[model samples]
Target: MTELVGIVLVSHSPELAAGLRSLLGQIGSAAVPVAVAGGTDDSRIGTSYARIAAAVKDADRGAGVLVLPDLGSSVLTARAVLEDHPREGVVIADAPFVEGAVAAAVTAAAGADLTAVLTAATEARHVSKL
Candidate 1:
């Protein structure tokens, strides 16, 4: 089978990222590559460029990588990593954390390419909670 598009979840809180990673497994696809870039190297409540950079590298499985950041520093760090160490086939989705991750994971498990997985993540912003 072809490699699935990998996913990286970035958050200021380690628990938040790990929790969502688990939720993606339950609500999305277990076969999908979901990696977490949460907290600092000291296990504090802040984003880390090093962790995000490593997660992006570790998550890529050749198909591509979709990064979903929670907010604030998480987004900044992800973008900084990209700007400093730009890599092809690695993109950060400007979508909701939980929703985008679930959408991306499920789409990748279905054998979608990087573009399609990205579309699923971006389109997930329109999902109504009502």
Candidate 2:
């Protein structure tokens, strides 16, 4: 069976991540594995390395994992996790959080490969917001 790429949304607020997940679901890509790594284990308003690492592992199902972080520290945390784990096919997307997640999820749902899914997410950078 072809493995579908997975998405991980990282944010300082659990609400933000959950809301994005809901939005993605409403967009009809619920079958795509989307893991939300938001806030600390204690529910604090910050990124947690452990949480992000766990989410990366959970989201992966062989195809690969694409991580979308909301802010500065969140990106740092995600990079740290990747540096620590160094998993092949896992990537940190340099794009807008919500937009990237949606695009990546939709691409993954269509059974795109890891690089393609990452491209979809990164391409969110080119979205024209007028």
Candidate 3:
């Protein structure tokens, strides 16, 4: 069986990440393996490297992991986790958080490989909001 790519959403607010996850589920990608790493260990308004790392590990299901960060520090924290882990299939996508997560989740639910899922996510950047 083909392995489905997993997704990780990082945000400064746990509510944001969890809300995004719910939104993704409502959008029909609930089967996709999605993990959330929002806020610090203390549940404060800050990104936690450890939380991000754990989320990445949890989301990965052999295919790979796609990480979407909400803001600057969240992105930095995700990158730091990637740098420390240095896994081959893991990647931090430079795509809009909500759009990218939805795109990636849908693609992954279709059993796409890591590269294709990442492409779907990155492509979200060009989506017209008008």
Top-lDDT structure, candidate number:
1
**Model 2 Cα lDDT, one tens digit per residue, 1-130:** 6778889999999899999999998999988888999998898899999889999999999889999999989999999999988999999999888888888989998999989988998998899889
lDDT of each: 0.93, 0.91, 0.92
Candidate 3 lDDT by residue in tens digits, 1-85 = 6778899999999999999999999998988889999999999999999999999989988999999999889998888888878
TM-score for each predicted model, relative to the true structure: 0.96, 0.95, 0.96
Ranking of all predicted structures according to lDDT, beginning with the best and ending with the worst = 1, 3, 2
Greater-lDDT candidate between 2 and 3: 3
| TM-score of model 2 vs. true structure | 0.95
Q: Residue 57 CA error for candidate 2 (Å)?
A: 1.0
Candidate 1 overall lDDT versus native: 0.93
